[model samples]
Target: MRKIGGLLLCCFLLNGLNGQHQVKTRKELQREVIRCINESAQQYKVMMQRLDAARFPVTWYAKEDKLVTSGSEPWVGGFYPGALLYLFEYTKDSALYKEALQKLNVLAKEQYNKTTHDLGFMMYCSFGNANRLAPKPEYKTILINSARSLASRFNEKVGCIRSWDSDPGRFMVIIDNMMNLELLFEATRMTGDSSFYRIAVAHANTTMRHHFRPDYSSYHLVIYNPANGSVLKKQTVQGAADSSAWARGQAWGLYGYTMAYRETRDPKYLEQARHIARFLLQHLRLPADKIPYWDFDAPGIPDAPRDVSAGAVICSALLELATYTPLKESKGYMKAAEKMLQSLCSPAYRATIGGNGGFLLKHGVGNYPRKADIDVPLIYADYYYTEALQRYRKLGMKR
Candidate 1:
């Protein structure tokens, strides 16, 4: 009762401060975040009952009434376990922790796979959270190995990690590669090895040089000649066109550079992250609800499908970016993030408590150019949504 009264007072004070925009107060947002986390915990528990040791939850097709499953080798394999860990940390549910450990066991071998550039998403999200909550030496070793495997893909000539091996003549690096640097940075921190840090910084610098436009919107892919490290082509594999901005790709760049600044304290990375944030927020196509279209430049504006996954990623990035800016800019970033969170928490984007095959979010567009996983619930959306809530709950009342 005392806590409730205190929060009510805080809410009143916040409303008085931000009366110009009619923003949700921190106290109000905190209550909603707590509700979302509690609801997510219950829904995911139901989801776990339907899964086996060998398969992980990926997405749900509501029209078909089906829950999609994937093996542990897919790029999105770790988000389920990572989300489970996040829930477990907050709720202290033993069932959630057990489910995460089982999934991590299946993911452990991927630390040595060395064929993909997503070990950060695969290993770091799962084992990284586990180590933070439980402090296990095995998790540490696994993460370090995963970082090493990711580092093995770095080409010295290109100054970036190879994202795909589809062609022998081309070294492909996507904007998404920035997210994987977190695992490499963690490995350097763990093993006291400068090589991993160097590789991550080199990749960030190279991506900064070639993957962005003058407006700071990012290209989805940049193909380099492997022999000479010269640019071969810049294209988009998942966007509306070769020159269009894929919404999630832009989100990935924002989150990745913000994370890079967090790990390295480099002002260039911070400035880059801020520019990307401004580009997304100030774009003409950004919806009033704060959720973005699948591709900012995708045809049929005002009617394009919204991507809640991108919104979730962007919200998580903005909350972090807010911490690195001055007081006024930080409040602006936080307001934008709060609006995104409120939009995501609404019925339009959130799944009903028991619907959408137990997934938390709706209307995530995956690989739209290929017509894959469009207008569905995505696992990464849930992971980052939960993560953003956690970050917001921690920082929302600091003012």
Candidate 2:
């Protein structure tokens, strides 16, 4: 009877949640953004003491009472410094800047690391913002070299940047590769070298052709024959099945194409981004709060774990997409993003002060299928949540 009663109550609450629509005005969002940023500043100051200069934060494992960390070479290394820079940008706290600079010092050597396709995440997010706020010749040089290292992964025959180095015969590209193109695009802008721009375009074009489904949902991974550039398999490692739409994969596509449109003024990328947004917004199972299940097609409906990281990424993308779209669509996009931010700020998702291992948000699913970092606080989740808050405040509530 107890188990049955619990199940009934859970369903009832979810149904009520689905029926509710919460909205926040620009002023309300501004206040929350300030509060969140200030909280982040305090939390990260504590987090800085938990790790030394050589390692970066990954997530906070509350159950273990541990702060999980990674080296500077992984894909997530930059987000620590990137988050610090974002916090520093808003707070102008010398401690935030000093901590970010320390992480960047440890991370700068990744510019020459040609072994991975994640230098964009590792270098650009850290140094790109650093260069933007405080331009340094060395930063520019590091970014250019990082872009060169990333560009070297592109295959002329495949018309895409190889994402993962596979066994002797296969080339693997994941939809996440789209996020890396911004580095290439920025490199071209910085160097006036059309080669980098051309590579970015080719990679985007090829991914558009192969990575997405008819409905704009993307495959997590597509494997190709290295010699002939022909696709051999389409599958997923993080989703429930080979064909299920992983929540974060969709978020990456939406953000990548929106960014592509911003850089190139290309109508197709805009259309692609809009399509992805619609798919996510209109999906039958998407919760009313806008935080989606780890996989859209996961077997457990209304009970699957929510990926707050995906929500943060999508919220940030939608805020940017709202600007470039038509007024009617833009209004919808902005309102949706506002709702997402509100949900993220609520006590259900946002961590309490001095809690969550010094991270800002909670309930992030890094790789659900792999049973890794499940329902934890992720560094990228906080980074993108901070980014979305910044973007929302900048847009304001003029409409």
Candidate 3:
């Protein structure tokens, strides 16, 4: 009778928990979530005051015409200002929204800022999502214009999106393009012309061909025959190019394809996403604590340090995969995600002290050549870290 009563009590608790999301509209739930987001966003604003905006163009580094360093990132700017727009969206704070729009519009006019790798991160992170959530026709116009600007970067010869913002023929493509394609796809949907979607699909298909090896681990960069569109070399373009596997690059593919499948509903994209997920789980070395190295193939971990940012990205991706994946496979992905979230929430990966910036993750390497922000803080790390938490908490409870 005691054991039976315990099981009944558990069932009662579970049912009530599952009811929260079902009963709330997206707007209503987001209202509550925004309360939490604002606390972090306010802290983030204060920290960002330190950055020198002119020098630290965020995301990827650019070419410097000097010898001591082949390239120079030289400073620290990142993609989080756009993320602030989310707080604005949820709160309807006109000031916050306007400030973010101003920043992106200014960035749009920046002639030097032209990397295509993070079109979504740079543009869609604010303006694109703004257009979707708010539906302002004028912002819609800006979003369309941004799409055209992004489409202009597509290399017809390579059939891929160009990245790294360097020389024209030194073409390089990376896994992060999957997120950028959504910008392009949405542009097509918004404009009712197929051209933007066509470019996005072409880039996605091209990546499926050139980036993945037979075993399914990916190359970070592929240089193409710019003149003829032949892939000249498939190199481990980042993280020790000598056959080392980058953990975040792997996560990008896992999440990217899952996202691709969500958009295109193509089985091949889902399979590729699964292939990478299976490889990571099967080989992931769960130390005493469960976070991962920046690179799985990187020698000397625990002592060398691990990247919580990668784990956070993968955790959210796996959870999304769990929702859409077959039931049997879903269990494993959710389990891995649980482990990652547990690791991130722990004292090891999380930022404990105050005023160090609002970023939740530690040990995220931007380019590594640029700086070693060892276990420091990163904005995207915090964004995805919080996302994984919210997703995990609301797993079966959500719409």
Candidate 4:
């Protein structure tokens, strides 16, 4: 009798533990999301008060417990203000809207910058969001000028925009350039000019031809002979190796192609987006939490530092992708994205109030090989995280 009672007690305890693992109800998930967004607003309110007018926050130095600031030229300069606009869209706080406008004034000069391929990230993200929220004649002028600046880098021979000015003989294009195409697409829509759209499609086709491997994983950088559009070399500057998959690069590819499909409704772009999604979702090394390692093939497996920025980008892209795909495909992408959002909102990745130099997400690895912005809270990470939250909320409302 004593032995039987002990066995019954053990069975009951096991069942209780199993019950604890049940999925959260819709109401519970909504409450948690609201809490996360509210906490983010509070933190950013503090950061805006502390930031200087001339400097833009880039990332947080976790070890030193300090905020990293950048000048206007930094590729990531626009994301800070872009994030504020997204937060304001959610919270409707007048102060956030005012702060975002002030930051945009500081970032406005980048509309004429043509030296780098990141003008899309710098101008479009900040000004694009602003234009969407509040349409102003000035914003339209700034964005059109920015699009023209970006268009200046397009090379007819190479069929792609110049990603960097380095090694003038070789035309270097990186996977990240895909994210810039949206600016061109938007410019075409706004200006009734097909030239911008033509340039964007040409670049996407060129990238699709050379940048991807048989397995659908992308190289970080592909060098081409500018004279004949011949491939010079395929390599990676920030990934684990030339052959390895960089987490953030994959995210860019996924998001870029997804946006391309939306703009063009091209079956090839849609197929490419689906392939990239499958590669990321089925990769053997992907973490259980859905936040990927800095590089998928980076050494140390489970011990590698996770890139929350990559995860945020993937989450936002997946949510958008879900809307385009068939129901069968959409289910997988949406489920994976929801899991990623839940992980990102947890305490491990999401910053608590007054923590992480007021950044929303933590553990972003930027340029791991170059030893820059490792294990930091990056502004881009926060930008995409807020975007993902908004996307998720909209998805919920639809359901």
Which numbered prediction scores highest in lDDT against the true structure?
1
Residues 214-249 of candidate 4 have per-residue lDDT tens digits of 999999999989998899999978999999999999
Which regions of candidate 4 fall more than 4 Å away from where they truly are? Answer: 1-22
Q: Which runs of model 2 end up more than 4 angstroms from their true locations? A: 1-21, 397-399
Poorest 10 consecutive residues by lDDT, candidate 4: 13-22
In model 2, residue pairs whose N, Cα or C atoms come closer than 3 Å (at least 3 residues apart or on different chains), thus clashing, are none
Q: How close is candidate 4 to the true structure, as a TM-score?
A: 0.94
Estimate the overall C-alpha local distance difference test score of candidate 4. Answer: 0.88
Scanning candidate 1 in windows of ten residues, the lowest lDDT window is 11-20
* Model 1 misplaced stretches (Cα beyond 4 Å): 1-22, 397-399
CA error at residue 201 for candidate 4, angstroms: 0.5
Q: For residues 270-388, what per-residue lDDT tens digits would candidate 2 score against the true structure?
A: 99999999999999988888888889998767877788899999999999999898999998998888888988888768888778988888888999877898878999999898888
* Better structure of 1 and 2 per TM-score: 2
Q: Each prediction's Cα lDDT score?
A: 0.89, 0.88, 0.63, 0.88
lDDT by residue for model 1 (1-399), tens: 995565356334423432333456778888988888888899998888778888988998876788899988988988999999888877899999999999999989999988899999989988999999999899999999899899999999999999998997899999999999999999998999999999999999999999999999999999998887999999988999988999999999999999999999999999999999999999998876688989999986655677889999999999999999999988889889999998787766777777889899987988887889987899999999989988887785674
The lDDT, on a scale of 0 to 1, for candidate 3 is: 0.63
Model 1 scores a C-alpha lDDT of 0.89
lDDT of 3 by residue, 219-260 (tens): 888888678899777776556454767777887888888888
